[model samples]
Target: MKWKTASTLALLSAVSLIGSACSGGSGSGSGDSEEVKDASAKESKDPVELVFYSMSRDSEASFNERYGDAIRKKFPNYTIKYIQRAQGSDLPDLINAGTRIDIHWDSIGSFPSSNMVYELSYDMSDLIKKHKVDLSRFEPSLIDAMKQLGNGAIYGLPVYNERMALFYNKDLFDKLNVPYPQDGMTWTELDELAKKLNVEKDGVLYTGFSPSVNHLFLTNQYSLPLLDKSAMRPTITNEKWKQVLELQLLQPTQNPVYQKAMQANKGKILDLNQFAKDQSLAMFISSPLMPLVMKEELSKFNWDLVSEPTMPDAPGVGPQSYPGYFAITKMAKDKDAAMEVIKYLTSDEYQMECAKKGIMTSLKSEEIQKALGQESAFKGKNFGAFFYNKFPAIADKTVEESQVPILATYTKNLNKLSAGEMDINTMMRTADEEASKLLDGLKKK
Candidate 1:
């Protein structure tokens, strides 16, 4: 509700300002006129080169195919220059050399860690107002995420989004005579279904469920913060975290059959590969990109997807939004041009194209949602599952950069907890302690 109000107010303000400028009222001075003219010229069909740096390790070819080509087609007069992450031309290298980076893009999770950490972030609030870019058009959670990262300043616009879903090997379910997972199944229901599928067959153990635990923690449906910024400490020792661990890790690992399977794999946790490649995993909760990423291996097995399982107390809520963003960096020579490019990228027209190409859009348009995966290799699959559940509100980051290492520590402890080496309370306690130590060490540096 707050996001909607904020966006509405912003839109109204931009409109009012534009109307006043156009009317040339007494308040509109000569300088204001020049500024308006300059802004208009920036959006015109003028030839300009924009250098884009991607921290997400997007290759030059991939960038061109996915975005560069489209941008060039849209603005034929514009020259697109892409600099991907590499050994010698990384962010630090570019910054040290004073390279002009007009736009910097990355997943939201990594944006603050890299771009913000380097102080390369440029607040796009004024540009957003000048361009009348309607933030309400995007998924509310996505805009909220960006605002949280910028501490109320608009830093970037979400280009696309990704979310977790329940991917099931239909062949495995048929083989074991278990019903397929449904869309609105709760965690308890999913656990029961997993137990039915976690049986030994043909001398091979079939794991019922193998979720990406890291993703689960990062995008938990409860919107839990991983760290306490005020205290500069980890929040892993809380009761909510313990409940999450018990449901996601402890309960599943408590199965003796699952433990035996882990032992056979030499204590390695079963992953998505086991589901896609080995076909020994029944249900795997993962991102929708899996369909395209593992197209070949997945084609060999009959599979379908359902909405990600929900917590009983938070029914129908899905994981928090994980979207990639397009940000205009502070090093840009022409901020207006950069903002224009970003505005175009997030427009409804481009978002529609992205959806048609089987790319998930950050917009909340029903038409775009329906067109999802329409042109992809997996068109006939249940694409509706992706939108079945409501995305949970994103939690504000505390120590934004400390998340990765703390999560790593928690993940390691999770393995131990699963193997009966530590109880849930002990796991949480130790993880918090280790995370605190890690934060202290980082502060010293």
Candidate 2:
């Protein structure tokens, strides 16, 4: 799992202070003390090399071009050295290898363990107060999510957040003679719209909706947990989870579009390109990244995006989550220097630059929003849809190793449910029982 790569280092030149201590009698002692003090001050003032480990594989050249230039201009005394590591690689092993990584930058989904990161609550609270860092500048959801992940102990600051939105093909809606899905509509309402769009015409099957089931659970707009942490058991047998699965699981068996695609594609799920470039899907829910990926094919089809469909039960809450977070590692050589780097990266100037470069900003400012996607391939699209959703309280992360097996069991049960071999109750109960066994086995080991 190792992908170790190092980028060329950039040195910042600083003038070194020279001192002399006269060598004779009592005056020499005082001169020696003064010389020592001057040396210490000079050492403190000397340029420091701050090693930054970014999880993303942006090469040193691109990093410098996009962000390093701004960073270097702001902190001339500290040189930023980009230390590269592949995502999901062994972070502790890299630390043990004596790599001087001062700051850690990674997506929220790929965050390193607490054993690797320094608990920043005490240190950052002081720095935040001393620097008068405006906590209000960042979105409350971003801050709250970080706090929740750390169990009220802040270990990181969010760099950027992402929200799920519903993208629809305008051409498909027009062809189907159905109105476009509106913002703030419930998922139930979306289901009806999807049914209307599921029509067969001219040898082409149009999919009304093809949302990712995994996304619904991961995003968990309803704050549902697959595993009950306290009891250390699976909770898929619950009514809430049953409804969640029924929403997407039954679609494949019930929807003509999914059935036809599965038959034609040899049992595989619907092809994403069918939805993106082919304009066969009337509506789909996904992150903002989709539009960026389909930017070239977008203009070929008339399409737009809206807020993620609301939860019918909950009404207006949306699942908002931060994608990237920056933290100072426990093994950092210069903690204060790392904090300064984080501060600079999250500052208004840096954020504005990021916004102009089409990088999403974690800061909550009208100016930044207006500037977002300015340089992106989706420059003129509905970038405003990103903010329409409200952030729900983040649920605790499931950390058990058995999560892999649990998800497998759930997938297997989904097949059984689809084949009519098991009812919803049987599907959930069997899945939960198998997941509980896996968890129990892991605990014993």
Candidate 1 TM-score over all chains jointly: 0.89
lDDT tens readout by residue for model 1, 1-445: 0112211112211111111101111111111245754654447487789999876555676667666776776566789999877889888898899888888877766677777887888999998887767777789999998888788987788877877788999999999999999998888888988999888878999889865777657878898877775676787877777777777767666787888888886886677667888888898777656665556778898999998888878888988767878889888887877777776677666666666655677889898788877776677888788899998887667435433587777777667778898788887878888887888888887
Q: Which parts of model 1 have CA positions greater than 4 angstroms off?
A: 1-42, 398-404
Best by lDDT: 1
Residue-pair clashes per candidate, as listed? Answer: 0, 0
lDDT of 2 by residue, 1-445 (tens): 1112110000000000001111111111011245543433344355878877664555566556554665666566778787545554345556566666667665554453322242322325564544445678888867776665566666677765566677888999999899987778777788888888888899988878765544656566776655776787777777777666666556534675657755665554443556776778777666655544345667688888887777667778876563567777666777766665566667666666556544567788878766766666566767666676676765555456223456567666554455455788887778778887898787787
| CA RMSD of each candidate after superposition | 9.7, 11.5
Clashing pairs in 2: none
lDDT measured at residue 229 in model 2 versus the true structure, 0 to 100: 62
C-alpha-based local distance difference test score of model 1: 0.73
Candidate 1: C-alpha RMSD after superposition: 9.7
